[model samples]
Target: MSTSLLIMGIGGQELIVIVVILLLLFGGKKIPELMRGLGKGVKEFKDGQKEDSPTEKKTEVEDNK
Candidate 1:
């Protein structure tokens, strides 16, 4: 509910302004590098989550035994 509210609060103009601010702060050359790093970080987090789930299930099974 709160997420929806937050999304709705940002109109097109607001998003454009935010994007313009980001471009000004980071410059064109740096943004791609920043985004690539961010993408890698998110991918690593997802891979960690995938690796974690099977271990958690295995531990649960051991506890039941």
Candidate 2:
């Protein structure tokens, strides 16, 4: 299992340091809000992709045929 940090050329220790820096910069209370926004953005992106999926449109057309 390759970690994304490794793909980005960062090591595990660098990941820890980055997390700690974020915590310090954003503080504990604000981190959850940031994560929540990130989650919502990802969910919205996935939903948008689903809405635009050509395969689903093709399937519907085939069913009507």
Candidate 3:
């Protein structure tokens, strides 16, 4: 299972409930915008992880020494 599902412990019913609540709160039109923003945030986080990987950092430290 994905780390998020493991951490949240949300099952099918709970996920459905959350989706229903989001639809009610944001409506159909705004949901896509929210999802787009979320996708961008996740992409940025992954890019940051790649730039800060341990092996690259180790090599930089060795080069400096």
Could you give candidate 3's per-residue lDDT for residues 1-65 as a string of tens digits? Answer: 56798688987788889999999999999999999999999999999998899998999999999
Model 1 per-residue lDDT tens digits across residues 1-65 = 35774777976677789889999999999999999999999999998998789888899899999
User: Which of 1 and 3 is the better model by lDDT?
Assistant: 3
Give the TM-score comparing model 3 with the true structure, all chains together: 0.70
Best by lDDT: 3
Q: TM-score for all predictions?
A: 0.71, 0.76, 0.70
| lDDT tens per residue, model 2, 1-49 | 2587678899878878999999999999999999999999999999999
Model 1 is weakest, by summed lDDT over 10 consecutive residues, at 1-10
Stretch of 10 with least lDDT, candidate 3:
1-10
Worst 10 residues of 2 by lDDT: 1-10
Q: Cα lDDT of all candidates, in order?
A: 0.89, 0.93, 0.94
lDDT of candidate model 3 versus the reference: 0.94
User: Alpha carbon lDDT of residue 34, candidate 2?
Assistant: 99
Candidate 2, residue 63: how far the Cα is off, in Å? 5.9
Winner on lDDT (1 vs 2): 2
